[model samples]
Target: MTATTTAANPDAPATAPRYEISVGGMTCAACAARVERRLNKLDGVSASVNYATERAQVSCGPDVDPRLLVEQVQRAGYQARRVDDVAGADGDDDSEQARRVTDLRRRLAVAAVLAVPLCDLSLALSLFPELRFPGWQWVCLVLAAPVVGWCALPFHRVALAGARHGRSSMDTLVSGGVLASSAWSLWVMVAGGTPAPGLGQGLSVVNGGGHALYLEVAAGVTTFVLAGRYFEARAKRSAGAAMRALLTLGAKDVEVVRADGTRRVPVTELLVGDVFLARPGEKIATDAVVVEGRSALDVSTLTGEPVPREVGVGDQAVGGAVNVGGWLRLRATRVGADTQLARMARLVRDAQQGKAAAQRLADRVAAVFVPAVLALAALTAAGWLLAGQPAGLALTATVAVLVVACPCALGLATPTAVLVGTGRGASLGVFIKGPAALEATRAVDTVVLDKTGTLTEGRMRLVDVRPASGQASAELLAMAGAVEAASEHPIAAAITAEAGAVPAVTEFEALPGLGARGLVDGRAVVVGREPLLAELGMAVPDELRAGRGELERAGATVVLVGWDGHARGLLAVADTVRTTSAAAVAALRGLGLHPMLVTGDNAGTAAAVAAEVGIDDVVAETLPADKVDVVRRLQRDGHRVAVVGDGVNDAAALAAADLGMAIGAGTDAAIEAADIVLAREDLLVVPDAVELARRTHRTIRGNLWWAFGYNVAALPLAMTGLLSPLVAGAAMSLSSVFVVSHSLRLRAFRPNR
Candidate 1:
């Protein structure tokens, strides 16, 4: 079949071969475009670049060599390495992030410096009649050009790049407005005569029949726009700083021992099988097994726990963990880019870059917004020109349409709100993956919660003890604790808690499918399930069986204790639901979301927990794969579902839900799958994040409406020759300021209870 199909389609062009290349040294929007341009110029290649993500997608013909493309990028002053896939690439380091921050800071400084003279000159020319210095005005315009050309180049470059890709963006709106206004004003000033043919008549009427240079208008707008972009860049940088902070936790330099001697090298240069020595109070530089020493190491940076853990020869130490007690020699098992810290940095980056569905909607809207506005402006200007207006009036109308219809305010609305909201969320110990996750929470109708480690305290605790026919409660607990003392299960933890100060056991044996048997006070003691006791030929009491039934109904697990060949007592243990769970569910209900509990436990246990949390709906004994089906069913039933969990088993459901939230300290896989990770492990934070996102979303919508309305209403008045360039510029600038001030309201918004 394949041979026949190939013979039939001989004239068809071959499928484009795809190449995944890791690009380096891309510092800004311009750098991204330069790389794209350089790559596109290569024979048999096509490329698409995303500057914000620092990634490129390339497709080429079979004749092209991927290695040659990478080498070409390197020769052009960037680092490029071919890989099987770009999606699996790791994030950059702190140094790379720091360099980007520095670059934005420099651009902001230049914009600030240029804005000073531009604003001063423009304000003086508008407010004071006699303070006009033509030379000073020209100086301000000259100063503004460089600022717009250099500091504001990203907007223009991005606009051009978008145009090349057959799309339009915010950059297109900004670049068109500033360039048109600036070029027109410069022409009038240099000629020192009547205004350019199309603008002179309008100027003649507005300034009372004399040529007027509106250079201040151009300079002022450019400076203000650059200032806005500078702050916007800073806001983005601040959000990225969290990832940088994580990366900075790794050691930058490490001490290495070679056959000759010891020396220092960058941590990235370290390799597996290399041995390194660590002294007391020093951190381990890589993941390694201790070769010749013992120490109490602090692994809190990776685990979030505070207590130091003891490690001896043959034990493994993770990289970035501190060695607190003694010196150690370690053989590197994993080093350099393979360390846990590096993996964590990569995870954070991946989480941030994963755009939510809501953001995609916003992007789709913005993609067509610029060209539509441009067409509107052109039509508005043509309508006036066809109405017998002079060339100058037509030109003024065109400029007004461009300036007033600029999407600067509309472009800023959502991103500014998201930036501020994410920053505040991070401070509150909430990690929202992206705008889509934030928005989904607002519309969530059902909340599926994990039972273990989320609704309840994950630790198992003994709730009750029942005495056998011939034994005291205290005596039974002592013997049971002694047997479980050497065990490592949750039941063992409970038993140890009850033991108090029991005598230590000499020998212990853990029965895999049953229980534990150990020598306590030189007697044979056993702790296990009923089946194990039956296998040991012990008789069960009727009262003990009834007690076990009651414990099971209350969501507790019952264990049997025996000494020699007789039944001692029954011990009951369960993980109790949190006290705050009821209130958190009620809060979600108050927000109009119906809360549901999904658990892997039996129906009785699930119902008990659901009742305690005031939730009426419960799905019990759900396997991990089945959880996604439950979520899908809820969605099909007209509910926008949000699934919350804290175990590796919950990961699939988390990704399947409309909004996936991982609660408590969960596994990395669960966190990666979630749209929101509640760092504080409180169910209440879920409602809090939802409330915050809704408030921010409302603010962004309000700002966008105001921005669009202001421009739509003002542009027509300016275009009909009723408003001059000076007035139009002032109105346009004030409208931008209004949008910004409106967005600042987000700083004061408090999430509702």
Candidate 2:
């Protein structure tokens, strides 16, 4: 997460060092924002805090030790430590999330066990007077004690932490409500008076007036809040499970080749420049270029393409991809953190740890919400006291208002949705960078797709073949395929693939800068470009001239097939338009987004590909550097453009677009610059990601509405004495639960193919 830039001052030896730290006990977006605010207040420091991942990305000057960043976060009211400093025992189950889950379950079990019985007894006492007996209050208090005191430890501790930092959070509300109810019960037991076995049996007042104890309120609040926290933790873990699974895809070990001998070692032990051999079924150890052997790699693990990609000498292979066919000897170009797989994992992690604009606003509201609620509670108490209500009733109303006004819901609204949305998208092979990328998708009106790799297969394929007026089609392909079998070019491969089982030529001669000459069954066959056809003294036949011209106009590379020194027929080769690309373009149109083809190919090629894929606007003849200017021009024209591409040449354009979606198989530069990554080669993910963003934002808006609406409606009722303290406690705890539960619904999101 750290990137060092040279200091602007020429004389300065160094600049600020950036550090990322993980802070424990951040229950809401407000807590993360508060930590970020405190860290940024320090001299020469700036920070971005993400609650979904519970990590802070911080930058500070060299003069300030990185350790101080942790201290600052601690000052902002949470437990803190540097990410690199905290090393748990190495095991899959030893992750921070696993530990949190274990801890939450334990606390929730204890609270629920005690709370249930206590609530039952309190409710039983209210409804069935015969169940009341001597020492019943004592028994209820005994049961509620541990539930509020021990089982509720986390909330109390966090609330105190917020107090020290002069900020209040969800914990503050929960702790205040629990402590007030518990203290009121204890105070009633000590001072209010003792009741006989049959006392209050026939009393119509269930309120208990000033003498009522709320042992159930204290216990129930603890149990419900802890239960909510447990489920919230589990949902968060589920949301990030895909990313964790991705981290495990890289090879664990590889055979490192040496001058003396090859030695098997852990991938961590291997370094750049080391050569390694990958077996037929083994995963590629790192990002490397093949030095020997040919194989079809199942790179779908990285690119989400269903087809196996052929890789041979000098072709680069990504780590985590399995070599499905033949063995490959590769020279390690990138190892450890430098590998593509590692970079992608890092991107997902870093993207998860970013703050969205909506979350920032929610945090600001929460920072002020708790204090305002407390003030409102105090005003309500004074107003009631002035109106001649008893002190106990006033205190009850105050507690109700304090408990009902939930900042937790507001704080949980955005981060939880982001967590589930990004996680679900990752599962779908749509790597949404973060909330900002999601936000960009919702606004973008035009999508620009690159031709070579985006809308097309990026590989040559034989599209058509024509034989002279009366000649057999099979005979023409037989001779052409025989000549092409001697070549290693992509065009040759496409022709050979479509040639079927053709008879081998007797003698094949290679033609440089042209086609080849061969002999099939004692007949002279010339296969090459038009120049080679002319060199063979082959005259263009009148009947096939129009057909050849049509193929050439459609962006195909046409080769002249000649035999016996005369033109025979024409064969066309072009980059295959992906079978799914037309549907993807149509889907974008249905979404009311204009799809344009932006390619550096010749106008004929670009227009032909565009027509095939239903793209009306073709921006052809674009220079690599000028791609950015194209995106900028679209922006100036009031189009919110999202440009999709797959190479280093597209990096600038990706960065310049309103939203940049890079292909997963693209160069590192493009992926790094992109706001979103199409991890799957399917063009459909473009519209899928956009539709997913719209859905996620819609969910966020809905959650915020419920959160704000609940508080707005409930707070007044609580103040006006329409809602009781017991009801208020239940409402407060459930509000947070509702927000988190709503966020979990996104985990069920399944995008259309």
Candidate 3:
């Protein structure tokens, strides 16, 4: 995400400048909402804070100082820094995340070691009276102190910070439970004398009538909660692995072509317009056009295609693509942030920052969830006291209520699923814009496909070659190819490609409206339309004319190849359909999407292409400007449409549709206007993109329901004294782990063939 802030001009109107602020010290969804509220309170400032990303996207009036925004977040008791200034490099966020994971692991290990002995001793004394040796409670106290104080310090510190700012969070509830349990146990040890043992006693908190000790509750709860957090942090880090892999694909060093031979330099130092050489098995330094040599590039890392693309001089090569054949000398057209690889990384990061609508509702609920649980705990304690229950039992029920109700699960429900889903999609060659686009995919019932460049190859190529009777096919093709090579038309190129290594031509003559004429192997060859053949006093045979008509009816462009005063052969060429287009259309039907073709080609040609691709509905002969009208007409008829195209003419229609998917090999304008970009040329990825979105959205819904349902059901059990505080802590932690683990399932999502 990029943000800009400039000096305010008094005479001009105030423009809202955007900024990204990296926020720290947020422990739950409520913390993010609090920071958002505080930032939004300023005049003419609007902010949205994402807890998953730990960044706030803020838009404020030009007159507002960005530093003032930082001060407001700090006042709310959190660390704040300008993202553009601090995280100017890529690896900074990864390093910070790694540091957090290590710290959590250390804390969890300490808590687990101390809690085990403390809980064992307390449980033994309560269950068996013979195990209650002299000063056994002192042994329990000694073991529990460090577990409650040092091991749980992170929770206490965050809770104290919130208290200072007059706020409450998930950590506040945890701290309250730990402190209450540990303080009550200390009092029992000091004032109540040696506690007598009881039969049928449960583990954790020990109670013998008037005197009840809860050192085990304090220690056990702290350890279990820490373990949950440790695992949760590791899961979150794994969710971003795809993006990290993408960053690693670039070349570290480049061979810069200099006046004094070629010099080796860091990729960062390579500037635009500099020429670079890439040998076999080397990655392209940046986005560049080939200036010398020829090679076949393996672009699977970028586009997910296994086939290597053959490229000669003047072909564009993207950064991160490996040259697998021969050598290539390239001039950099784009470097640094201007390259496509950088743009892709930015898009992925920006997509992760958006929150779904359900997540927004969950955040609102969590913002007040902590305080509500506190109130409920107070009521539970008072009700139990009034109902003739002992004070010890009532306190135990209240502690359970505080520990059982978890807002952490509610905070994690949506963002984790989105992170894993988007990352997995990027690996499979699908780039979703954000949660909104993923949501849009769920409702799309119709897919509007542009015929050219989408289902078809978009470039003319050889389809067939026919030779006249009593003529050698090779000799006729060689003469025609030599004459047509002098012309630069699409049909001529196709013929030249088919007749590989043809004999050279001399005395080539250009025909503007027709094809060319040249002397090949001491023979005068003329290749063009029938008019060119007739102009050269050449008569076309009846069989070849019938053959040309047959090819044209099938949507192929036919051209006559003739020499020696007669038409010798008919060559057919057309924009052929992709091998995967038929299966892609079938897959769309399986997903219950009605696919149709909308293009600028003639009705006959469009219909033939549609039939080949298994699309029954066709809207042909429409102008490029009229494509948007077709989409609007469909929407008016109650269909949600997704349009896929790959040209500048399709940009408007793509933007006008409900969901827009751009082909990866498409123009820049089309890619920019799209909601989802298919990074591979294969049409099969289109269905994969839709299926992944539907599956991800389903996972998110499941997580939200589980999170909300667990709290609603567990709180009642805790309030009724059926659940102990130690058990409540375990359940609460498990709820968060389950939510994160459920989201991680998206990493295994496979593309539907």
Candidate number of the best lDDT: 3
Model 1, 560-614: lDDT tens per residue?
Answer: 8887787788898788787778888999999998888887655677788888889
| Leading candidate by TM-score | 3
Clashes of 3: 0
Estimate the overall C-alpha local distance difference test score of candidate 3.
0.83
**Which residue window of length 10 is worst by lDDT in model 2?**
196-205
Give each model a TM-score: 0.62, 0.80, 0.84
Ranking by TM-score: 3, 2, 1
Alpha-carbon shift of residue 374 in model 2 (angstroms): 1.9
TM-score (C-alpha) between model 3 and the true structure: 0.84
Q: lDDT of each model, Cα atoms only? A: 0.65, 0.77, 0.83
Error of 1 at 467 (Å): 13
Provide the RMSD of all predictions against the true structure, rounded to 1 decimal: 9.8, 8.9, 8.1
Model 2 stretches with alpha carbons more than 4 Å out = 1-16, 85-94, 164-167, 194-208, 292-301, 306-315, 323-326, 460-554, 557-573, 624-630
**Better candidate number, 1 or 3, judged by TM-score:** 3
Q: Write the per-residue lDDT of candidate 2 for residues 158-214, one digit (tens) a residue.
A: 899778778877788778878987787788788857532111222111244566676
